[model samples]
Each structure stands twice: as C-alpha cells, then as structure tokens.
Target: MTNSTPLLEINDLSLSFTSYAQGLRQISTQVLKNLSLKLHAGEVFTIVGSSGSGKSLLAETILDILPKNAHVTGSIKLDGAPATCAALRKMRGRELLYVPQGVTNLDPLMKVGHQVCLRPEQKQYQEAAFKRLELSDAVTKLYPFELSGGMARRTLVSTALLGTPRIVIADEPTPGMTLDQARETLQLFRDMADKGAGVIVITHDLTLALEISDTIGVFYDGTIIEQAQKSQFTGLGEQLKQPFTRALWCALPQNEFSTPKHTGAAGHATSSASTASQPESKRAEANSQVIAGNEPENAHDAAATQASEHTGGAGDATSSASPASQPESAPAKDAAQHAAQHASVLEAKNVSFCYPGSKHCVLENINLEVHEGEIVGLFGGSGHGKSTLARVLAGQLPIKQGSITFDGQALNPHSCSPVQLIFQHPELALNPRWRMKRTLQEAWDVPQSLLDKAGIRDEWKERYPFELSGGELQRFCVVRALAPTTKILLCDEISTMLDAITQAHIWHLLLDHAKEHSMGMLVISHSEALLNRICTRVISIDALNNHANCIEDQ
Candidate 1:
C-alpha cells in the first residue's frame, strides 16, 4: 500500500430516496446502507456492483445530490476536514469532479469548448488554445449538436480534467468509447494518480476494471461485500479460495492474470486446479448443451450429480465431452434459410436528421442497413448522432432529409413504428411511479399468449421500475418494444450501464430472442469485441461523416 494520507473518507454512510404515490406522503426507499470507504491520495479505487446495488447512490450522496426528501446519515471527510453536504455543494467543480455515463452529461445546446472553459480563470486557457486542444477550433464553435460519440466522450473528460479536482468520480467513463479510447482514458486516470490525485471509477465492467484498478471493492445488496488488492481479485485459484467471489472472478476474461512477479506459474496452476475441481459429467453436459442444444436443466442435473460425487477429488473433465455424449443431429438447413430470409429488416438510405434547436444537421446524410439473424454494429465518435441515428431508426425522431424503411415499408417522417429504441440508461426512460404492467401495456397492445411467451408472467406486472434489477428492466424494455411488433430492434448503448457478466447474458438472451422471432437488430456499441462477436457488418459513422474516406474491410 502506498504511504499517503486519505484524501476522502466516508464513515457509516446511508441514504434513502423518496417514493410518492396516490393519497400518501413520500415513502423512504433505502439505497445505501452504511457504506464506508477511505481513498488515499495518488491511488485509484473502483466500486464494482450490479445495477440498483446503491453504488450510484453512494456517489450521489457524496456529491450531496440525493433527492430533497432523501435521508442521509454518516460523516464524510475530505482531506482530514469534516465534510458536510453544504460544503460538498459549495466545493463542486474544484475539489471533486464527476463524469456521468454517456456523453449527454454535456448540455446539447452548449458548445463543447464553452462547457470545458466554464472556469476560464482556473483553466488558464485562451479561447483559441482551448479550441485547439478540444479539436473544437472547428467543431467546438459548432455546438454539441455537431460532435461524434468519441468527440463527445473526449470533450466531457477534458471538461472534468480542466476543473482540476483533487478527487474525480467517474461513472462508466468508457461505456460508449471504442477500445483504443477506453484504454487511453484509463491511462489518463493512471497519470492522474501519478500526479497525486485520488480517482474513483464506479463501473460494472469487470474486464476494464481489472485492467485499470489498483484495488477493487465488490458491492452487493447495498454493501461492499469484498475488498482486496488487484492481484488478490484476479490471482490464480483466487476464485476457489473465495467461493463467494468465484462467480464474478470467472465472469471476466481469463487473460487478465497478474504478471509473473505477482503470481508466476502459480496463477496458471490455480486456474487449472479450479477447472479440475469440476465434475466430468457436468463438463460433458455443458459441452453437449452448447454443441447439441440439450436442455439446460438436464445438463445441470447430470453435472451437479457428478460434481457431488467428485466434491473432494481433482479430475480432468476436458475430455468428458466425448463422442458418446454428443447429440445425434444434422445441420440446420431451414434455420439457415430462415435467417437469410429475415435479412435486411431495417434500412436507412442517406438518413439525415436535425433537432429543433440546432441549425446544423445532427446526423448528416447517413446510410446503414440491418439484416435479420445478426446484430448490426454502429460506430462513430460521440455527438455525431449515434443516439440520434438510433432514434431516427426507431421512428422516435423525424428526419430532415433521407428515408428509413422497415420490412420493405417506407416509414413516413411523421409515422414510424415497428422499431424500438432502448436508451443507454433505461431506468431514466421508465416512469418510476408506474408498475411494469402499466408501462408495458402503455407501450404496446400485447396478446395474452404473447405476454406469456415473453416470460413476463403475472407476478412481474405489479412490480415498479425501481423493484427490478437493471438487467431485468432492460430485458423488460426489449420485450415491451417487441410486444408492439417484432420486425426489428434499435438498441442505443443499451448495455453501457450493465456489468460485464450481465451484459453478456443480456446479449445472449437478445441473440436467442432474435433467432426465435427471426428479427433483425441494429446495435450501437463502443466495444469492437462485442461487435465482432455479434454483428455481421460494422458501419463507421466517422466514415459516413466523411464519405470520401469510406473504406470497407470485408
């Protein structure tokens, strides 16, 4: 551990938000329960958790942004001084800087350079110099309206850094950034730590967090259930050593092991030991289900029984999936034909859209297409209208020029449906006061059979948005969108807020759903790996922006 004074400390902190309903006063909804942490100067700390785990509330409460009726308890100290909510508010933009998820954190109407130069005296930059750094000498003069996703992400980050805060709290800093951008931003944070600033990144991305975090804290059920060094978090056999942490440990990419100095070959040995601990029957079942489409329960039952028998023995299960365990099946010919037939479900021909307040077009002459049976990935620097494109495709926004067609039907600028856009943060999109059923019903006219088929049974109807997990709510939104019609889906940074494991699970579920419905989807993502795994073709909005630079890799 580094020998440094704690820059910020939270002691027994708790927070509750207000929930109001008919004929009743506001009811307190507890979010954080006695959360505590101490961050030293020149160090990086990450808080990892699932959605609705109160991780966000902790950050908000630290910034004193909890709702008016919300209750806060416990003491917050900054640089050894007693910190109060009033002090926190007064010191904002100086002592602490916050970068919220999505580029929307920056006001759309303001110029990117103007937003960054909010504290001209503190920033000590001439208007011209700032523009050059922000690449806004051209774009900054234009408004948030004209930037791309990468540009917007960079601008927001520059603004936060320009504030020169002692402690930076970033929520999903790399959510919608490409791999290179994500790596660059994390390196920037590492540089910040080197410069004697304390940085805290609150994210659900286990892989990114493991790659960057000096220390990791696991939050669950409104509590930090585990805290350990980065080595301890991902070291070999680390999972078997801590069964409670195993699920999370294995969920991340296996390549994130510490260097030889930390674990040496011991790490590999430990991983092997964990693998050897699994029963042969279970391994066979898992392989059969993946390669043969066997029932999950049947596979799990056989595996579990074998695992129980080999509970204390080390066995090699890699060879368990022998020929005998394989299902006797032929290739899926009709499935291939079905997938091919559903191709080109959504098409955008030279699509251009402009917001009411902006004089310049937000999305300039863009052409894109989504085929059935695969995810079409959208890539562009921020503010170039990735979300706007999603909205236009979903028929939520009207295009100033160009056309969008769904299933061979031309979509009028005024009337477009059959496409649904799931936002980066669905919780904000949902009405907190309404139950799931009311919200879904309001969005779609669902038949009884379809409702049952969607996996949203009667029990979930009464549950409000706040009652469901982030993944569940996101899935619910997709189901609701599909309820109206199931031709195509438009997802805009949908998994940006989810943890890696949950994000993976959601994507798998989406693929299954798409296959089941024989539908097409246009998915907007910053992660190239995700696109590579799911999309048939990757379209760059950057290339679209500069048509002369268009280059196809296929």
Candidate 2:
C-alpha cells in the first residue's frame, strides 16, 4: 500500500493481555493473533464476527486505543507512512475519528452541540460539519440527557464528521434505531467513502454490512480469514459452491447448514442419515395419543376424602353449611353486567430513578401496568433509563423507590423471578467461554426434547461464539432467553442491532411464543416502527412526563 494510495493497512498484528493474582500464578488472554487488513481511499470495509472474537479489539488497535496492559505487535501504515503508536495517539483527535457501539460516547452533562464540537483539534470545523451531518439546529442547545436514542446517534455521527478524518471507524452504529434510520445512517457512511474517506464498520450484522460495504472481511479466531468484494459475497448460490462454504454461509443468517448442495450426494446423504438416526426425532412424528384411562368420579371422591382426612381436613366443609350456602361460582346468574375484573399482572408505582452520582432523573413519577397477556412498550430517549427501567422490571436492578407487584404478589427486589431480560446486543450478553449448547443449557426450563425439535441443523454445539456472525449470536441469545421459566419477558432494545428482515423474524417468533403460552411482556425500545409492529400499547416517556400531553394524545 502506497502513501496517498491506501488510507490504512495493518500487517501481521497481534495483541494480548496479562493478569496476575496477589500470590498465585498469572494468566494471559490472547486476543488478536496475526490479523491483517487494508483500507483504500473511497472504500467501505466491513468486519463481521461473533461476540468476543476480537472484532472490537482489532478496531481499538487501529484507533490506538488498546489498553496499556495489552501487548501489541503490528505494523500500522497510514497513507504509506509508518504509523507508530505515539504518532497515531498524537493525531487521534484530528486525523482519525471513531463512533462507538452505543450512546455512551456523548457527554450527558453537556449539550449535544457542545459535545459535538468538544474535540479540541477539530474545533474550527465544527459549524460546517454540523450542517453537513444533517443535525438539527436545536441539537446545539439540547444536552445528550434530553435527546432520543436516534438523536444521540446523529450527534455522534456529526461529531465524527467534524474531525474530517481520513478514516472513520464505526462500531455497531445502527444498534438502537428504526430500519429507515439505520439505512439512512449507512447511506451517510457510503457517501463519506464516496468523497474519498476510508470507512470501516465493525459489526456482526451481515445483512446491514452487505447493504453498504464495498469490501467484506470475515473474522474467525482473531484473524481476518476471508475477504472479497461485497457483490461476490451477497449471492449465496454463487458465493458458496462448496460444503464448507455453505456451512459458513448458513451460519451467517443464524441458520444451520452442514454443507453445499453441489457436494457429492453421498456427502449430503450421510449427514441426512445421521440426522434421521438421532433419538427423539420429530420429523417422522405421528399424532398418536399416549395416555392413561381416566379414573371414575367415585374413585376420585374416595381418594380426595382420604387425603382430606390425612391432611387434617383443610379441604373439609363444615357440616352445618349446605350446598346452597356456598358462594355461587358466578357472582350472579347472568354475570355479564357485573363481572369482576382480574387484578393487574404487574405494576410500577411512583417510580423515580437516576444513575449513581447523577443529579437528573432518567425516569420520574412513572406508573404503569402490564396485563396478563398484553405486550407493552417502554419507549424513550437515549440514556433515559429505558434499559435501566427494564432492568428494574426484570429485577436486574433495584428500584431506588416505589413498588412493583406481579399478580397481586408484592415483588421483592431481592426475590424477583420468572422474568427474563433478552439484551439488545448479543455480543455483549453471550459468554464467549461457553460452547453453544452449554450456553443454552443454562436456561434449563426449555425441554431438551423441544429444543431438539426446533434446533437449527447447521448449528454446531461445539463451536465458540467467535465462529458465529451477529445474526447467529442474536438467534442463540433468543433461544437461551426464551428457553426458561418464562412468565414475563423483558426485552431491552433487542431489535436495534438487527437488520429489517431479521428484526421481523425475531418479532414474529416472540409473538408466536407469547400467543402459544399466553405470556406477558414489557419491551423496551426506541424505534417507533418496531413498537408499532409488536406492541399492543406504546407508552412514550415524553407523554408520561406531561399529563396534558397524554390526555391530548388519547
């Protein structure tokens, strides 16, 4: 790669970390192992890998942000000039920029305008970049604390553009926005590259990456194992003509595949035969009833009487009470006019919360209820404690004050159960150390038989997270979360990181599961479109803040 020819090139890069105990031995975690990549001017490079596969580490290394405790050995060349650690660090704020995974990069205390232009090196270019980034003028006066999740993302994009850097590195930039917003953001990145800047996106989202990237790089085991033009990888039938290729291909979509169709019939047949031979196979299932004959009423009465006597007659009725004295099963003969309503399933009362040391409340005076089988949405601005509130509802976090009751049972913060939280980013939620089966195994309540029935064929339980794509990781997360003792499902912005099609599939799966079991849910989200699709009722935090607004909207 020549100077002024290629924007950046990394050769034989390796990085790792060391850990030592007080008096015992030490340990090392090998991260990136001999990874290499190149970014040309006016091109978009996408890196796709599962969680804990060193994708983030590789991006951090390129940005010169790797931890000091880590050992890094690599040659990073920028525009053909040797990029030393000191040189990269010295020019970081001016010649290079990064847009991080979520909304945390922006300063909450400062107005978005001030935060966007906070870069000392890029201060002079802030005004022009703000306009170029398509940020609203009102954004300048509003702090990050007040912006919606989508708006916060726009601020970060504006901030990165302000630097006018030669290369822009974005890590999971579209994780919390609607489909339209995600597409538009990707278009912006494409436009940036069209103007000669190098753009590198680090994500597990293959569908999103395929849409905008010029070049695609697949990461496996801390290395860039494959690279090709985006066009070459998009056509599944064309891209994968071999068995191994097809396995990787199917894995990308969160589906399981063993090999390619073009492989010898014997190869395919052997795999199919193995699958057929497995015990508990339902593909050949018959709808035959397996039951014990019903017992007679007299027999049941006799058993009940004996059990009542042995248990000290808790089930015994008083001799003086006649059958007519018992309260009617229905309050009235024709009860429709005065039917008693069931109690609310769950409620949040007068809840107010703020992060530790923060003066502003993210959520305030919040009162809400979830009925037995309805799906509710907690829609709000970024950092407004949407995740925090979901955490509280799922008992992951304790409410600072207020109460939550489930089915008339007071919810004890320390003893909450039967509620599950499916995180938005699977990469963060999944354990890298566990194999696929072991991870799913922790859910326990999902019948092993049912799992086997729904199991994706291409999935290899032996493979680690590093070998999977974003969609694959997300599917595993879904399987793990839903395969449990589920009563209430608390979804924390799960769809924000997925592509439109994938999001639709996940939403449908959730709906189907809920319908099948009559489950209740409280879904936390920022995308109105997604809420409109899956939620029965959408409760905007802004509306709750003003009673008049709620009344007017209603």
The TM-scores, one per candidate, come to 0.72, 0.59
Can you tell me which runs of candidate 2 are displaced by over 4 Å?
1-4, 21-23, 108-111, 119-148, 233-238, 241-344, 347-405, 408-486, 495-519, 524-554
Q: Please state every model's RMSD to the true fold in angstroms.
A: 11.0, 14.5
Instruction: Name the runs in model 1 displaced over 4 angstroms.
Output: 1-4, 18-26, 102-109, 122-135, 142-150, 233-245, 252-335, 342-344, 349-368, 383-385, 396-403, 412-416, 425-438, 445-476, 536-554
Q: Mind giving the per-residue lDDT tens digits that candidate 1 earns over 1-554?
A: 35665899888988776766567765666767888889987878988865557776677777877557778888889987888767888778877888765454678788665777766584454343334333445555656645555565566666565645689888766665666666777767777777878989887766677677788887766867777676775454354344334545544423221111121111111222122222233433343343232345654444323212221111212343322233423344334444455455687888777667655666677877666554556766545567767877877788888888877888655643666677765665789899988887787776665444333446557678766655557656766776535667788878767654445445544654665665667778766545534543456666566532211110
lDDT of 1 at 346: 80
TM-score, predicted candidate 1 vs. hidden true structure: 0.72
* Tens-place lDDT digits, model 2, residues 368-437: 7765455666665443456666766776665667777777777655643666788765666778899777
Candidate 1: 10-residue stretch with minimal lDDT: 260-269
Q: State each model's CA lDDT, in order.
A: 0.61, 0.59
Highest lDDT: give the candidate number. 1
